[model samples]
Target chain A: GQQVMQIPQYQHVQEGEDFTTYCNSSTTLSNIQWYKQRPGGHPVFLIQLVKSGEVKKQKRLTFQFGEAKKNSSLHITATQTTDVGTYFCAGQLAGGTSYGKLTFGQGTILTVHP
Target chain B: DAGITQSPRYKITETGRQVTLMCHQTWSHSYMFWYRQDLGHGLRLIYYSAAADITDKGEVPDGYVVSRSKTENFPLTLESATRSQTSVYFCASSESGTSNYEQYFGPGTRLTVT
Candidate 1:
């Protein structure tokens, strides 16, 4: 069975500060996806990383994939109150049988204070 | 309306009772998934369907059953619920069952078993 581990189970940051969460998979992944869930809300797709060593950005947020395709990281700069939520990283194993199956990390709960 | 939706946003049932959670997507996506989210376990896959009548077990499928009679509906049933089955359930759909597809999640259903 595949597993995705996430770091910083909980984080509290002052507004305008920075935040980062890391993710690692037990097995190589075909691709990785990131999601965010607001308080009492469903998770929403944020971004996806496919190529090794790839980096993608959405506004003040940055996402990176490790060269081995087994790890990833998300960094948020100048964090705002709106960024308070749970962030999750999920990995899809590399195989034909995988078929849209995602092994999700435990998730990092982020809290931003004013 | 247009996106994925789950019925009975909140439910409370007895330990030995049976429960069913409904999931529907208007996008006509080819892939649908069911996941349970606990406090620390994050999101564990319960079952998934590639298309109508094609379903497979995921990481945590025990005590649960799923059926996909049509492309737009995937229902999950608990034959005999237990206290351990109390958690938030999310239904998601994707354009395809391929590695690169991103999932669209429904609002989620919270079930409490006493």
Candidate 2:
């Protein structure tokens, strides 16, 4: 079975600080997706990384995929209170029929203080 | 009004009782998934359906059953609930299983089994 591991189970940062969370997969992944879930809210899709050694940016956030397609990282620049939430990384196994199945990491809970 | 939705935002049931969670999507997505969100375990997949009548088990499928009678509906049933089964459940849908597509999650159902 495939597994996705994320680090920094919990993090507290002052406003305007930076944050980063790493994700690793036990096996190669066809793609990896990032999600953010606010308190008392459902998870929302952030971005997806599919290419090897890929990097994508959205406003103040940056995402990177490992060259081996087995690891990823998400970095938030100048975090704000609105950035407080749990971050999750999900990966799909490279081989066989995925059928839209994903292995999710334990998630990194982020807390931002003013 | 044209996205994914889950019924019974909150529920409480007894250990031996049966409980069902309903999910509906208006986009006619081909893939639907059920996941349980625990405190430290994050989101663990329970079951998934590629299309109507095509379902498969995920990482944590014990004591749970799923059916996809039509493209828009996927229901998860707990045959005999347990105390350990208490958690927040999320239903998500995607247009396809490919790596390029992103998932849209519903507001989630919080179930407590006593």
DockQ, every prediction: 0.86, 0.87
Runs in model 2 deviating more than 4 A are B97-99
Clashing pairs in 1: none
Chain A TM-scores, candidates in order: 0.98, 0.99
lDDT, candidate 2, at B103: 84
lDDT of 1 by residue, A1-114 (tens): 888999989999999999999999999999999999999999999999999999999999999999999999999999999999999999999876766878899999999999
lDDT of 2 by residue, A78-108 (tens): 9999999999999988988888688899999
Candidate models: Cα lDDT each: 0.94, 0.94
Under CAPRI classification, how is model 1 graded? Answer: high
Least accurate 10 contiguous residues by lDDT in model 1 chain B:
B95-104
Looking at model 2, the pairs that clash are none
Give stretches of model 1 more than 4 Å off. B97-99
- Distance (Å) between predicted and true CA of B4, model 1? 0.7
